[model samples]
Target chain A: MNIGTRSFQFHTPAVIIDQHTIAGPLEKQGNLTAEIDQFIPDLYDDEKTYELCYTKLIRQTVNILMSRHPLTTYLFTGDLINQSTPTHYGLMETLLVPVTFDHACATFGLSLQSAAFMLQQGQKQTVMVGTMSHFAAVEKQFRFPNEYGQQKPPSSQTTVTGGGFCILATEGEGPKITYATLGRVINAGFKDPYNMGEAMAPACFDTLLCHFQDCQVTPADYDYIITGDLGAVGQAILFDLLVHEGYQVNREQLIDAGCEIFKDHQPVMSGGSGAGCLSLFLLSHGIKHLFKQSLKVLVIATGALHSPVALLQTPIIPTIAHLVVIES
Target chain B: MNNKLFHTVAEKHNPPRPLLKNCVMSFIFGGVICAFGQCISLFYLYFFDFSEETVGDPTVATLILITMLLTGFGVYDKIAQIAGAGTMVPVTGFGNAVIASAIEHKSEGYVLGVGGNIFKLAGSVILFGVFASFVIALIKLILT
Candidate 1:
């Protein structure tokens, strides 16, 4: 049911039944390596092209989830690839009905929100929510050739090569999706493509504030408030924005998935940013932490909604963020 | 917050780049590449019957060959990240740009892919280089 503007409260909250996350070898250097269910071993994944490898990530993730939950009725998934081909092409064999959602790195949040709505409406029994992103494939589409010699600015983020999948049902014994706040396209008049965290931070702030207002809960109500793929810079900016708005933001409770995914040793300038960044961290690390104790977690997944063509037309990058409240 | 205020906050959070370090690194690595080229030119002068003027062509070819191999081996980008303009300002960077595009497009096909997109990055370099030279030549002729 609709709560306030841009927020929804699921009457019968959707529950996560099971989850499986896979990442590339580079992600093994991170702190959550043990939490990840599987690793792709390399970028190629025994495929001819990086595009095909991306498809493999989606295929393998869904196939694993489907095998665990054979009664899944639908697949809600997306990626950063052009036309979201990886999700469509990967699920060619899976009999589940596919619905593609694209909101850049926030694809996972969109997928989760929609899946929860479907569950609450009794439209589907089990919905498999998933998202994939490959470093080489996304680089070819968004930036430069893999072999091209280019220096990325400190604001730039590494596109994570991974996929995360989870099964959601109306009645299950797992994390419950209770509330979701849909974010509007917020353009803060920032234009640099390399500095995506800054471009997307305002959207995070908007959705987060909306979620707090609509849910009637303060930051202290939740054990943790996680933002998707904001990296180090955006995290700082988000803190400043919240504090400026007369809200007290606990530094320990507010963490970014991008900063959590990569260690300082990695060459990633800011940190990891991709559709999988949030999903991978949530499924792997966040979920485990929730199970350890009684906690309420707020996940605000953010995305920079601009294409190479769109960037050419308007240098400004418009961004969005989706908020999901998960409880143990 | 308004767009203007948000910009101020964003800028405040963004850490500045290490400009001095980049400049010093670029200068050192760029000099090293040039010194390596000089060694190749000197080798040609000693071992082969190439003059100072004629030596330019073979030396350039050798540098391009080395760059192409590095690009193919996936080693050039890592070095270029640290070297910055040091690796990019040289002719070798031009060769790597072309070869990198060709390799990236190989998955599409050799005919319309590699053949068509080979000059995608380097096309502007060639066009502008020739145009600038032509303009200089016309100026010289007029002065004579």
Candidate 2:
């Protein structure tokens, strides 16, 4: 089936598949699943809610794809673990059989490259590449700056709860993956342990613009361009620079998943900084409608490549973004 | 005989100077500050027909302007000395200091001389507030 020619249909009112359902099947495999279960107890209601929300998003994507196409395998990009949490990785592994996880150096381009390599090796007919993130857990784990009495202006209220999934099926008559490119990662490697905004801004901009160049498309080529978690200030800076470059991208198209999911206008401090911000959006919103309508979509997921060592040393960490093109 | 002597001694005492002064000034200055805020609110309502919520903009602007003028006249320093934290804690105090300092050095170049030094004291405070919050967040992220 040609995804490009045929109209894509989406299942209405998405449902989250609970860990209990996935766990039951995984339990038959080995003790690793049990070890993962210990970290996340079903007792905490919020934990259950997070899992349920993400599960529902994943289930919706799978249901939609299975109904539309004749495919067996699916692929997930990177950052399956929101904050390197074992529970998150375990949950993600259950959904996609052949999963690839990489470190900060593996740009989005490299990660997607690896996913393509996995598909080639397995000779899978259809692959669903999806990602989910519950930033609430990551936020709770790492209290964001806004929680510490910083007054955030009212305009910072865009962060909303996020979850999204995209299925990449083998070249059929359906939607085609026109081009996938990853920008080079740039870091001044300066040490500014206190405010990451100063350090991250430069790295994020250089790589993001570079990815646009690699794709050989101006920012105006696509109807809409979506960025991962470049919080408020970063978003402002990126928009300013883009406008200066003669590309007029609407602020709405530059969606910051971290800010969107946050609900409250609380100073997300250095804005939204996490992997989950982008993943959740892609899983929940990125693919569903665009494929059905056959609208061209460009997705750029940005990440701050910081290790515990870099953070403690107060060094400005570098950032990288992966750009993917979906055409129907 | 002992009880009568003790009663006479007790009657001869006077109140502490600082304590009495503070109590008296608090009533006078506190009333003045509150009245100013009320007057600003009323003005906004009368001219703009602003609701209570809408009055905040004008009230804040008025307070800022009044504070700035007072700072220039050096009256705000006296108020601060008398009221201590009471004067500084309100939004008006911050507005006064910001504008007063900016205008005081207006003769200096805008970017380098005046603008650079205008936020000197306030800049540190804002930066401190921002950093303190970031640290607290870092701690929470680590421990959690």
Candidate 3:
């Protein structure tokens, strides 16, 4: 049922039955390394190109999720690659009808919401929601070459090198996605692509505000309200915005997926990002915590919707965020 | 909040770029690269029959060759990151910009990928370089 202008409360919540995650060498040394299911020691993964390696990552994630829940009737997946080709190519042999989405880093929440909506309609029995990103592939497409030596600011985020997928069914014994709040495209007149945290923080805040109003719950109600790929810089900006909006935000409860991936020692500047960043965190760490405790969590995935071509033409980097409330 | 007000808040959170540090690093590294080029120029001058003016061609060629090798080895960019515009202001940076794009687009194929994208970044540099030189040449001719 529609809760607000952009919010929806599912009659039948979609349950995440099982999840699998894969990480590359750098991520293997991260704080959530123990939670990751598969580890690829090399970024190349013996593939000729970075795109091919990303395709392999998508294929592996889908295959693992399907193996666990073979009854998966639909696939919702996306990535940061051009036209999301890695996702399409990766799922080519799966023989499942795939709906590819592109919301940059916010793809995780979009896919999850779609899966939940499909399940709510009682049309699809099981849906596989997945997202993956490769540092090399994404860098080549969006920024610079893997070997191109360019100094990045402290606000810049390193793209995570792996991805995650989960099997969501109408009836399952796991955390249930109950609410979704879709964010409007927000441009805060910030033009620095290097400082993506600032560019995307406003969108996250916009979505969170809508979510709080639509659900008629405060930030104190949820065990956690996690933002996707916001990193340290973005997280700080978000907290400031929350305070500005007169919302009482618990610092501990409001965490970020980007901040959770890498340890403080890692030289990832602000933190890890990409479509995989949030998915990896949710699948590897967040979902597990849901089963351990009767927790109510909100996952807000923020995406920078500007392309290199558009970035050069315009000064503003528009962003969007999608919020999903999962309860156990 | 309005975009203007929100921007102020966002900007406050974003740490300012370390301008002084970047300048110092760029100066030192750029000087080192130039000194190395001078050493290569002296080597050519000492052993070859070329004069001072002609010696520049071989010295530049040698620097570009070295840059190509370093870029292929994936080490130049690492150095450039610390050096900032130090590596980019020189001819070696130009070589890297071309070769790096070529290496990155190699996946598409030799003709459409590598060949087409070889000048993806450097094409602007070449165009502007020629245009500026032409403008200067015309000015010099008129003055003469």
DockQ for model 1 equals 0.84
DockQ of each model vs. true complex = 0.84, 0.01, 0.71
Deviation from native of the Cα of residue A222 in model 3, angstroms: 1.4
TM-score of structure candidate 3: 0.97
Clashing pairs in 1: none
TM-score for each predicted model, relative to the true structure? 0.98, 0.48, 0.97
Ranking by DockQ: 1, 3, 2
Model 2's DockQ score: 0.01
lDDT (10s digit) by residue, model 1, range B42-109: 99999999999999999999999999999999999999999899999998899999999999999999
Best by TM-score: 1
Residue-level lDDT of model 2, residues A1-328, one tens digit each, is: 1122211112111112111111112112322232222122221223333434444434444455445553545544444334434324434534445454443312333444444444445566555554433443333323321111122232222222223334443444444445555555556453433333333444445545655655445766776666666566556656665665577688776665445444343434434444444544444344333355656666566655665555766645665666555555
User: In candidate 2, what are the lDDT values of residues B76-97, reduced to their tens digit?
Assistant: 7556656644566567656655
lDDT of 3 by residue, A1-328 (tens): 9996789999999998889999999998889877899999798999999999999999988887788778777888788877888888887888778888889999898999988998999998888887888999989888987777688888899999997999998886998999999888898888888888988998998899888888788888888889999888889888988888888888887789898999999879899999999999988887765446898889999999999999998877999999999998
Q: Model 3, A320: alpha-carbon shift in Å?
A: 0.8
